[model samples]
Target: MSAHGETPHGAQGGHGNLNQLMAGFALAALLTIVPFALVMGEVEINRTALIATIMGLGGLQILVHLIWFLHVNRSAEEGWTLAATIFAVLILVIVLAGSLWVMKNMNENMMPMHDMEHHMQMEQMKSLQSQQG
Candidate 1:
């Protein structure tokens, strides 16, 4: 009712908002920079470990953005936003898994490098013999 005509539900003592935002920003930056450093080999982690760590950090950053910037919480919209987020995550997982499955199948069915080179050489020989004849 403070001149804005809308009720503020969870207004903490005035200074908390700025502090929360700064903390979220710092965490997001740390999440981002650490992953990049791991990727660049500055942390000396195995490729598998690095990938896992990066993905974990990415999930944390997503949560930070959702909770802090987007302000999506249990109280927001009677929890419809959280439901939608879960659905979206489900869809993303299905699509990514299907894509990886298809790519792996395609790779398994593809000709090996030696076979491709041999095929190319055979085609070239055929072309040269046809030209000579």
Candidate 2:
């Protein structure tokens, strides 16, 4: 036991592991800046590709943060954490994909097939002629 009356291996009294964790978090934060700039900047990224890349990278960042900051690893509740992570990811993918599919179908089915402005103008003209006559 150290002067602080705690186990040396535990995180409470040890600065080394804490410092390493802090550094990892800082690096992860720094890494995210590039993605932020890419998203915010005027560069024309292909919409579908960009969406896919962003999703993939965002998932990767989440995993990194889980490992570095949350300490979800082989040594830390290994099987349960892994199972939970997989289940969460599976649910997210299912929901997102299902919503996208439904939205695409709805857009295709409900969108106007003709020029809306032209249709509205013709209806207005007919109404005016009926009123005048």
Candidate 3:
């Protein structure tokens, strides 16, 4: 029994100090600010590279929150936090992938106005040619 009440045995290492918390906050802020600046500012970057950079920063920000704010270390709750994190990540991946796939298929199936007009014109031309012949 310590001053902060009776913490379970072997589960006392997750709580970080003030300095560590501040460092994590700073890192999270940097992770956020850089992307905001990149998108908001006039910095021209390749679309793919920009997306990759933003995603990488987002992952790092998640790590900082898990370790610092959430205190989701392996020692906490006998690895339950880690397991939950893994499960959540898995669900997110599945949902995002499925949504993208659905949208792509829908886009391929749906024609734009221009394409529809062109197809209609071709059909009318074929009908006229047949009537003349």
Candidate 4:
């Protein structure tokens, strides 16, 4: 027996990282294919439902990448990896939401061309009246 009460690099044991990786890849591929087919094929899914399904699949794909590609498990580094990942995701969401909100507000509050033109015309009328007085 070796450290952690497991044989050293033994087959058919110790979480089967390769098998898990293959499963994760297969799941990710399936998620990708489903959405692609929904978009490209003749399926008549509702637009809102389709979008929601796509987003859900994308989130699952992210989880698969995290667990399989990055090897972020519960025991790894005392779960610091998971914690860091959550923190990073939180930061990303905050930044993206804040940016979008600012852009939307800017677009909503901006003066239109007609409003500017009206203001300019009013100013011209006031200048002419002052000059005439």
User: Which residue pairs does candidate 4 place in steric collision?
Assistant: none
Ranking by lDDT: 3, 4, 1, 2
What lDDT does each candidate get? 0.77, 0.74, 0.82, 0.79
Give the per-residue lDDT digits (tens) of candidate 4, residues 1-133.
7766667644433445777878988998998999999999958989768867877787788788887677666764448888998888788668766876798799899998999999999999999999999
* Model 4: lowest-lDDT 10 consecutive positions: 7-16
The superposed Cα distance between candidate 4 and the true structure at residue 32, in angstroms, equals: 1.0
Relative to the unseen true structure, what is the C-alpha lDDT of residue 76 in candidate 2, on a scale of 0 to 100? Answer: 57
Task: Tell me the TM-score of model 4.
Answer: 0.57
The better-scoring model by TM-score among 1 and 2 is 2
Output the lDDT of residue 132, model 2. 100
Q: Pick the candidate with the highest lDDT.
A: 3
Clashing residue pairs in candidate 1 are: none
Q: Which regions in candidate 2 have their CA more than 4 angstroms from the true location?
A: 1-16, 75-77, 102-115, 127-133
Superposition error at 17 for model 4 (Å): 3.6
Candidate 1, 31-107: lDDT as tens digits? 89988877675787685587667767877888888777777667655389888877876787687668767987998
* Higher-scoring candidate on TM-score, 1 or 3: 3
lDDT per residue as tens, model 2, 1-133: 8797777656532434767788777868766876687789846979777767767777777777767776665555367987797788889889878987898799878748576777898999999999999
Q: Would you give me the overall lDDT of model 4?
A: 0.79
Q: Which stretches of candidate 4 lie over 4 Å from their true place?
A: 1-16, 91-133
